[model samples]
Target: MPKTISFNDNWTFTKTDSPAYSRQTIVQGQPVTLPHTWNDSDGQGGAEAYYRGACWYQKVLTINAEDLSKRIYLEIGAAGNMGEVYINGQLAAESRCGYAMFRAALTPHLKQGDNLLAIKVDNSYNNEVYPLGADFTFYGGLYREVKLLVMDDIHFDVMDNSRDGVYLTQASSGEGVFRLDVRGRLVNEAAASANGRVLVQLKDHEGAVVWEDSQELAVADAAEFELSGSICNPVLWDGIEQPYLYTAEIRAIVQEQIVDTRQIEIGFRTVELTADQGVILNGKPIKINGVCRHQDFGGIGNAITKAHMELDMELIREVGANSIRLAHYQHDDYFYSLCDRYGLLVWAEIPYISFPSTLDPDSRNAFEQLELLIKQAYNHSSIYCWGVQNEITIAVETENTYRIIKELVAEARRLDPSRFVAQANINGVADDSIINTFTDLVGYNLYYGWYYGEIKDLGERLDDFHRTRPDKPVLVSEYGVDTNPNYHSYTPQVQDYTEEYQLLFHHNALETFKARPYVLGGYVWNMFDFGSANRKEGGEVGKNLKGLVTIDRSLKKDAFYLCKAYWSKSPFVHLAGRRFVNRHEQLNDLVVISNLQHIRVYLNGELLTEIKDGQPLNVIKAVRLILGDNHISVEGIDEQGERYTDEIMLRHVLESDSSYIYVKEEKTEHVVNWFERFDLSAPGQIEVKEGYYSIYDTIEQLYRNEAAKAVFLKYFAHVTDNPFFEVTQGVMSIEKMSQLVFYGIPPELLPVINRELNRIAK
Candidate 1:
């Protein structure tokens, strides 16, 4: 189970540089939120604001043992910057890494009364290593979560699970063999002098033991073991369709007594990468249409909920984005689990961004944090690559940062050869000789068109890279220009972060990839706008809106839908009641952003349009196809113009759901006495049919008989998933609508939505 009571919010603060006990002071604390960097109050939310200093946070926790003799533990979900935990007046646990969970046994420090859990956080900007050296912000404070746990010392089990661990590899549709490996550390509190063996067993979903093994342990504390077992007639686990998971239980027996037991989720799948085919999963050659992401969300700042993370994943899935690059650094396990459960491929990385690491124990400690990351995120199948660094050339340009990165990648390979090693793209002719040999897959984070001038033909970049490094697979790790659409600036050059350039950047880059097969994937610079301490755009501080989705997550600029279209994930229609105000050369009734040649569009149960060679979107004069809940279908005809169609259902909302419009109508004004901040851009369109996303499919006939981009008319289907509008307003979040969008109805509607959302949210 996840650690209890996340440790991210509402903690006391102090500025402490050393671990000296006297540095611990009692100060009034501000209600802090996790998933947020500490500088939210400062200008740190901006992409260009630079703020740094040491800080500490304290949380009051109720520590209780299940049994009088059981041990209690204080688990820090993840500490941003650097931090130390103290119970009452004594040291309990300490950690660095803005991401990663660590625990310290608290039984010895707990008193018979209430406890004050103080965590000292040092959030200073280091120009030598990562974040500070990178382009994003390095927010402060203990940013993740902290948990209080109580368990038996002798029988405790730490089952940190995420994506792929070990399970049955299905032979056919549902048959396969099982492989199990259960691992954990055992602590010996009482003198159980006699030695024993830790037994690991694999059980099928039916509760039958498919395999079992035991490892003799002659020690305590951190005793590692391996249990190998295989199950015939295996049940392969998949996501969305046929989501299956096997349970691996571990039992440590000492002197005929069961001392420990734990369970973990395991999926059976294999991943491979090659220069010729890019990525191969389950024996199928696959290309990654991926997006780069940072965990911090808008509105709530960093104090995000599980529902928000799932919504992010759902957005990724909805766009048919098959992969995600955990860009720049390591993120929380919550996001990882969502990716794993959904079978989305991922590239998990460390915060080795921009600059060189602070040498000495600080860097070593960072290395140790990497070990914890491996143990914590090892089993996740979604993570296909372990990224060692991002743009290490900045630090390595002077010092040998690549030397250390090479060692780390080598170590990671030794730790788990099941996945590939990816070195974050570095500039200035990085020691490619070493990286090429050490890295299984090489990635380049080129900002040629962004930081530099616009590269006329981005696809030519693919061709150039292929020609230079033809043997190794290449991925465009970072692309997409920044765009602050709501606010406009008058700049003729593409340097202006306008909505047009943002959309145009993706359009050109994606078109480039469409012509190249050696390229495995390309992730946009980011998925959503995030908070950054070091940012200044339009002369304002706080929150960088470079994301396709705005900081508040209420709006999707033209680029957001453009990306969906170029991804070849058609038949999606959002904001169907409205058409894009701008006319682009590519928009079409049946848009085909691929090299597959001919395409046809249909509407209202009849064929309507076709584009081939270089037919423009306005063959109908304008890209706007008469907005409404119109039936649209698309057929991917072969070069010879033979057809294969896909259908889509869209809901058009011209008038508000209610006739006596609450806000739209200026009637009565309803006393209009409330003043609260709101994220107007969060909800764009909500599609509905028979209450939910009713996807109708048939053999020959397709959706509405024509290709319909769902972005225009399909955001109203599941009022349940978007109930976020009621309490939060706009689209509803799952946590809010869990009850409604289920085998049941959502919560009752609330007036003054976002205000009530904060109330019920508690």
Candidate 2:
């Protein structure tokens, strides 16, 4: 039998890249454990100051004399961006795909005593990598587990993309019969040829054998074999209702002596995607109530543990979400296992996101990463869609971009024909773009209410897409707004960063998704706030606040309960606006969210109103309150006569609280009427003098001139410190500054900026 040992302790790590340091050199660094990162602190701090470079980690592995004769291998669960492994000062193996697992044989490099092992991991900006640019922070380190596998001379191949070497394909052949195809590879390192029998068994969840088969294997160095079987009336692995699973155990026996064995948990199910209907799982239609998740935690960067993953799954389950979209890249294998047990449909994607590199090597890297992602996660039954790209055309769309995406879609289908391929197009991508039609399913990251248009326009925009492509299955892959719990408002509006506006946005969005069944379903932008080093919005730096739960997992925003009311089956009532305690108006609207149909409201110990057949969101308008503090409570009873209650206290005030508002630092008094004096219609009025910079010039052109750069940065830096300016500098024209009024840039400042730039000669 094979022995797997954890190799995660007593490693020395340093953020600096010591080129001279090797196995013979002593490393001067702090001792650390596996699943660690250098960006835990700096990555969460604002201002794009996080460290993104090469780091060094070294560990000493002592091999016993008795174990030196066996086949020894070292496995790295994951290394960010890229990594290289060295044994005894010699390069052994390298992995270009940052988020995939890989292993290297250590038998040739190991001795009978201590052996020096070192790894160099880099997360720096590389055009050849898949995620050249994205919104989330890329933390650098050996952020996953490491293991040592000791096996006999003849064993299952562990070098096939770091897989289990056993591939099982399950399908429904007919009305009560299912077929299974098993493919496996083995490696024989003995001095002479070996003959063995490979036994394969299918066992139910109760550990009872349902089917078995054996195959003869004879090999010198490497060999491959296949086996086929069938089962009668196998239980189907349904959605959240009942997720049944079976186990496949494979063993290698030499002369009736078991040498090596591998076990894998498997599930049998069918998924169908249609143009009019949503996801059909196990011959039933199901809406995908999903939330997108980033594998990071507050103050932890990307060095999360199994406990952290479990907590995230608990929160997702609490919100009554039936699915999850593991955004941007491949996640931990343990997380996939959790999804399998919990029965959450998943949207697994690669990190070919945001901007596409024109380099051909980058395209090849994308293909290789997709292959590793599919092969490693092929056994998980929770994954229904393989997302190829997300917002890939946001920077610039070209012929190469279209070709790369088409090839990725084709490769994903070719690798695993059992699942469908999907892509998340940017909101601006036209309905007629060929990129949208490249994948089997299509999704759009629409933010109508939060970014550009009114909240009500979401439904209209979705309708337009459905009308244009009635034959395509469509979904909203991402939708959300940044919200801060410290801010509150009675008149909620877009970009306010208030808890009330966030609630209103999701309320309207949920209603919109429910009204249209042709539109598959939507996944919330994020389940928790995550680190974005370039962001300085919502009165916070280095974070995107578009999450139902806070990053620390301490507080659940009011929008969370609103979702729970609609999706969760638990009979409960929640009084909304508990965080917004102070109000200036004497008469205010009291809101309550509950799953129960009947709800009773009380104000200051008096009966305020009783609502029958109440919806998920109940609003009692124009309820009079006392001059000082008033108590509000809501109650609901389930069918079992168990009462659930929620209460809060609100204080009525005559004046507004300035602390509750987010005030921009720039003064707006002097620029109140500056827009009236400027003209935009007449092109001849604002002349672009020869050898001078003007609004007609691109931002890149202005930044090239020392005098023009200073003038442009003085005003624009007050609104956002996002590095997106650098991304769009060469492409976006300075005239687009007028459209930044939505982002808190004053409309009047555009002419002033152009005027100052025009004064400086080119």
Candidate 3:
């Protein structure tokens, strides 16, 4: 049985005082666990402001040094930016890279007696080492898995450590001749040269012999080795569709005794990736319908759980997407494993975000991380591409970084030929010809009307990209913005600035894709609102609300289901609400549409019409101009030819006139509070609310006018200038909510007041 150990326990700690290392103070704060980090608490500004310098952590562990008599090694999952290990005050090993795993042998240091382990966690910024350009806070301390393993005299020796993580290389198909290359580094911290014979033992289930080997290596010098073998009765591993895993154990032995051991799951399947074909698995064309994800959620920050990741994947799968891009940096191992089991395609990347202009060092880091990513994740075949960077060229707005990225792309392809190499850019505008020379595929993070205004201009942007670089495959990597669902009131008129407008925006986007052959795929700007301490919605209080789902993952706006409808082929007939047949009579009846492909609209099981072209966008029909709870079904088509359908309840209202207007008054109490108290949050919410409300046909105009007016209210209150939406906001001329202070109204009714502004401005 595989031995299980825990790195979570009691430890003594002290803070280093001076560079001389003479003054040190011991303090008790809290307990820590392996596979952990001081990510959240440190650098919190107030009480937990992050401190620099040396902090030591010590722990007493019970070891079977006598009975086991085998080689005992101390394994550290990860440390902060950098760390040094000391067993019984004797320096054991030193390491860097806050993200990878490292281990050190402790048997030689053991004097057949009780020992103490101390680790110095150094998180000070170092411009020379990796993870330097990363934007987020570099929390100090040990923040990964830690363990102590006692193995047989001659166990399996470790071979490689990749950024993707430590794992055996995986190939497609198990029946063919397979080579198992076990790689690792053996560090000998000794005065004299220590010679040890490394014996590689390959064992299978039922204790069957598959392959084995041995090599003479000197421990004083860290040496590398690769073991090869073939399995006759091979077991293949695949994803959910054909789930199967074969286990292989490779052990390093010395003098007929095991010393180190490692296990791997073998999966047989080739990932055929190329520019023209995209990603192909098992000889079939596959599209990576994925999302660029951030390793964060509402409250959890980066310490998200498997449950959290699963929920996001579940949502992605529910929307018929089968791939994901682990944007900007490497994530926890659990996420990649989840992809393997769930059959979601992955594009893992490094943390070379937009930074300083000079990037020669980035090249070296990229090369190192590339090796780490490929070597560690070589076993799992879910990864499709290695995303280089997102809009760094513009974020830094430099030429040198562009050249560095260009060379790195070529290097990535040379390192990992099987997987595709991608770069998330800010649209192929500036470095047009240069981009195609480097990347296998180009992903453009585009925000047409939202950021630059003129949503209609997206076509021209796409046209220019195709005209400039026609050979490269294109993708709309990121789009969408913060949207809120609670606010109500909308009209389905063109340019009306309501939920209808948001619907039109996406509808236009979807239509745009249908016309463009250069576009392969597109993912929204974000999946959900995440936490960024510095971002107050830009002078506002809430976090990133751009997700189709809310920050807490609780609320999913109508935009979520609406976008789902565009991509969903399933049958869906929704009765939004009743329309105005007559105003005074107050008829609670409306029209319903099918959100799926040709689903014959049936009223009481009578065929109303055959929904053909508008299957996705238009799925409903007029039914007594309806209201209240109603039974509906999205007809599901299975092999049996039995159709299925989905139903929903909506309270539709009737409109009396083509043009309607209303104005409400507020008291002086509401005015003083406006200046006396400023909620930067209110301004930020205006855009998100508009983005969500823009689901209606005329939502943008409403947003351009009402939401813009509200934001201006707050900005004009203090700054007198707001760069929030320079281009987009200019489309509408409006003042800030301070007008409310002058008019004397309730601050709570800002939504209503904003809506009235939408009516008056139009």
Q: What TM-score fits each model?
A: 0.70, 0.91, 0.67
Q: All candidates' lDDT scores?
A: 0.57, 0.84, 0.54
Clashes of each: 71, 0, 94
lDDT of 2 by residue, 628-664 (tens): 8999998898777889999999999899887788775
Task: Point out the higher-scoring one by TM-score: 1 or 2.
Answer: 2
Give the best candidate by TM-score: 2
Q: Write the per-residue lDDT of candidate 1 for residues 229-342, one digit (tens) a residue.
A: 556656555433344666777777777777656666566765667667777766676777888887776545555678878888777776667788987677778888788677
Model 3, position 667, has a per-residue lDDT of 37
lDDT of 3: 0.54
- Per-residue lDDT of 353 in model 3: 53
Ranking by TM-score: 2, 1, 3
- Candidate 2 ranges with C-alpha deviation above 4 Å: 24-26, 46-48, 667-722, 725-762
Q: Which should have the higher lDDT, number 2 or number 3?
A: 2
TM-score of 2: 0.91
TM-score of 3: 0.67
